[model samples]
Target: MRCPSRARRTRALLSALIVSVFAVFCGGEIASAQQEPSAPQPVSAVQLQSAIAKLGDLDYSARTNASRLVRRTPAAQAVPALIQAVSEHGDGYVRYRALVLLSGFNDPRAKDSMRESLTSPNDRLRAVAYSFFEHNPDRALIPQFVTAFDTEQGEFVRPAVARALAAAAAGDGVEVAAARQALIRDVARGEDFFRSSVIEALGDYKAAFALDAITSVAKLDGPLQDDAALALGKIGDKRALETLAAIQRTASRQTQPSIAAAICLLGVNCSSHESYLVETLKFTDRNAGYQELLRAAATGLGALGVAGHQEAAASLFDVGIPATEDSTRAPVALAVATIALRSTRLMMTLLEQYADREKAVALLAEGFDMLEEDLDKERFFAVARRTYWESDGASPRRVLMQTLIGTLDF
Candidate 1:
């Protein structure tokens, strides 16, 4: 045991063992640092159940936080629990929140839950059901929606029903014509709130046939006036220009942004109107009244971005660049990303045209980060991913978009 050669051999082996252990530990750290993040572990059954239960928490912040946690659950794992909660949750509010969360998944499995909720006694649940169908329009549901629209007395629920009807009308299939007429009548009469909703849907669907009805609404002096004007512009019919311009001249400051946005959408005096929108966002005194006005202007810019206005994208960046607060910056970021995601070419061209391309990319990435719902963020991600793969691999725009999409963690 005391022999010199044995002692030397023992020391060498121990030293080698220590080196091997150190290498393994340090190498793992290095590999982890370089690797893409691992897929999140599935939430345990108990944890998921607890989170689902919290969906109905009395505290608003608590409920919101719980919602965020449940939404982050992988769709494959979350769908079953969500469907169950939506279907069998004892609490009405929990059932409503579960359905709302489930709708975000947009899974075919949740369709039955959503359909059943269409007749739910809870007005909020009924509203969410109508909203789900608004995006996932089924011509088959048109007759049922028509009946609901006639009978739905809940103010909030009726507007959603109106939107669903408008969506069904946009689809190419049976009963579309009937859906269209129902939607028009909905705007022409019905409660102001319901009519406002139908007007919005017409604008969203670009129902040029509803132009006469929307124009009449635009001429009226009230809340629907702005909604109808915006709808007219979305229809892209130059015929509405005279009406929009006339409204702008007499519209109050609060209503002016909506009118200006409509005029810009029609490509008439866009520069002036665009400048006006930018000016609206530039106000330093953000009191409650100013905040309301700012939100309105932000919404206008979002509409413009959706319409693929490159200049408006630049303007969004211009407004977003200096904003420090997340609340202040979120709308601007969302507007910028909305424009960029419209098309790969538009994104590239818009960024290249911006004063600072680096900041443009950063802002777009930030916009992706600000998407509230995981499903919404996923949609934008899918669009960005599709555009990236479709473009020439060697194109600079492709490279730029790839970089931008890479920055999106959602």
Candidate 2:
């Protein structure tokens, strides 16, 4: 299901927010991607096999160097070897790494290995398979996903299953429709963690069918209510405005920022909600533990900016360009960077129409600055390149995306 244009603005914003928030609070990788460096030259098949074997080497450096060689090998040679390693490697880590590299190839031959890996004894492999299906949705595999939904119990793996099912539900077919209903059922009655997973994926995919169910969950003053409200916003149906407004008035202070964001996303009474997010971000009492609130506000503003909220982008530039603290600046920079990268046409229009070009570019640079690791920058730009190629050839966004790539490569 395609989101209304407004909801599409939040697409990449949501992904970036999740990555930034997790890194800030949980100390996790920011925007993780199973990316590899550009290939140098083709290696002999024997040499490639040796490198693949070293993927499971006991020495960390050996494994690391082996990954580089394997990744840099041309896909014609690397893909088949990776597929073979995924199937027959003695070490589970080697198998997992092989599958990850295979995903980058975008070759159809890797599908069987990906499908079989779903049943692997390794939890990590199963998680990777679910992620693979999420990106490569196959109607033929809907039954397999349904089975995984029923039986998969790994904490991390289950969410991947939910994401895959939600993505598959985006297709047109009776089986897909059934899969959609089952997903809503899971959201309604699944255990706490699982429900959260399903709800998030539904929102991420902008599944319109789950609106009423998500709205009902929003009305209840339960733990899932916030997630439900966010999903409703992402679904982008204005009909949920009344439900969102009601919850906003009575929700706890900590949750209001998210509700406000959801309300803004619907493009109704957005200015007030945007103001509320700014106030929440500028809240001064740091010792009282309001960092979560700040992150929420930053994420919300990022969504607004990406959605073509010129005012929201202005606010981010003002607050983020000069900010120093990681807790405060990192999320803001991410918001600004997303606006520049994901909504290139809109961002370019804003910069041209307004006078914030230099400052906005500076803030955009700050976003990259936050990505200290070379791997993280590579993943971020890799995503940018994919998005650029995927966009319409004649679109202004495509042109601006190319400009962004050159401007930000430093």
Candidate 3:
């Protein structure tokens, strides 16, 4: 090519440099544009307020969605708003939802609102507040619960207050003596509505001093008496065991099973009670008056099973097979499942009794649900699959097998 003029050559070089710079800048911009955005932080106060209000939405799904959103918000910003919603909200369900959401936040900032709700004149609010304490117990709030239990007069409030007291007492840094005394006073003199809760609280606290008071209540004939006997049994004291034995002897047939359950729970020598429990299982009559006794006996057998008593499992299996009474089958099946967890081979033995494969599969499904540990669930699933097989693709047993396998995956 012919030599260009110096100015023209300089201009061409400048133009090339400009193009190169432009290409580099554009490439950087394109790369920046292609990158993913960071997750968005929680929305502002106004948006959170909107979400809180949506909690009261007439549509159930909308309210549930709002709850999920509120739960994800930063605890510092969300706790106060949630507490206010629980305290000042007009809709009962919305307030209840707020209380439920507040439970997820471990922040102590929500305590004041919880205390306010605990003392609220509204029974439902008080109940939710107590339930909140159950999930998020604060040792500092123990005295407040004790005071609430002392003064709260509403029947609905009493049970909640009792539960709150129990939760707070169980926590560290609580004055055990004061909590025990408060529970005992309520069990002895509080209204009948509070009695069952206070009795249970005593058992949780293992208040040995309250033994005499609990024993006195165990003497009377009512649901409260059964609760008292159970409480004494949980205390696991020698005196408590002796008192339960006395109640077993003196109580009518209707009440004896509960006493027997208490005795069994105490880990006493329950051979006599075991015989009684097994006898109760032999009766196949579902409509008979002895149904309550049968349930109580089955419950006792399950307790024994928990203690790893092999005979209890055998007895439960005996009752579960050929259990014509639909009402009794659930308890018997549950007991067998409970024992089967301890003795894996016992499950196969129990399954063998049910000639009806469907019923056997149903009981296996129930057992799967009752097992809390994942390892145990997997073990059970493996055993169940190997035991039952369907050569036919259309077999209904396949459905049960699939369901059992799904539990392990979940």
Best-performing candidate as measured by TM-score: 2
Clashes of each: 0, 0, 0
TM-score of each: 0.68, 0.71, 0.57
**Which candidate order results from sorting by TM-score in descending order?**
2, 1, 3
Residue pairs clashing, model 2: none
**Where in model 2 is the C-alpha error above 4 Å?**
1-40, 56-65, 284-288, 302-410
- Candidate with better TM-score, 2 vs 3: 2
Clashing pairs in 3: none
Residue range with the least summed lDDT across 10 consecutive positions in model 3: 30-39
lDDT of model number 2: 0.70
C-alpha lDDT of all candidate models, in order? 0.68, 0.70, 0.60
lDDT string, candidate 3, 314-386, tens digits: 6776666667654566556555554554455654454444445455545544443433222233335434444
Ranking by lDDT: 2, 1, 3
- lDDT score of model 3? 0.60
Instruction: Provide the lDDT at 249 for model 3.
Output: 76
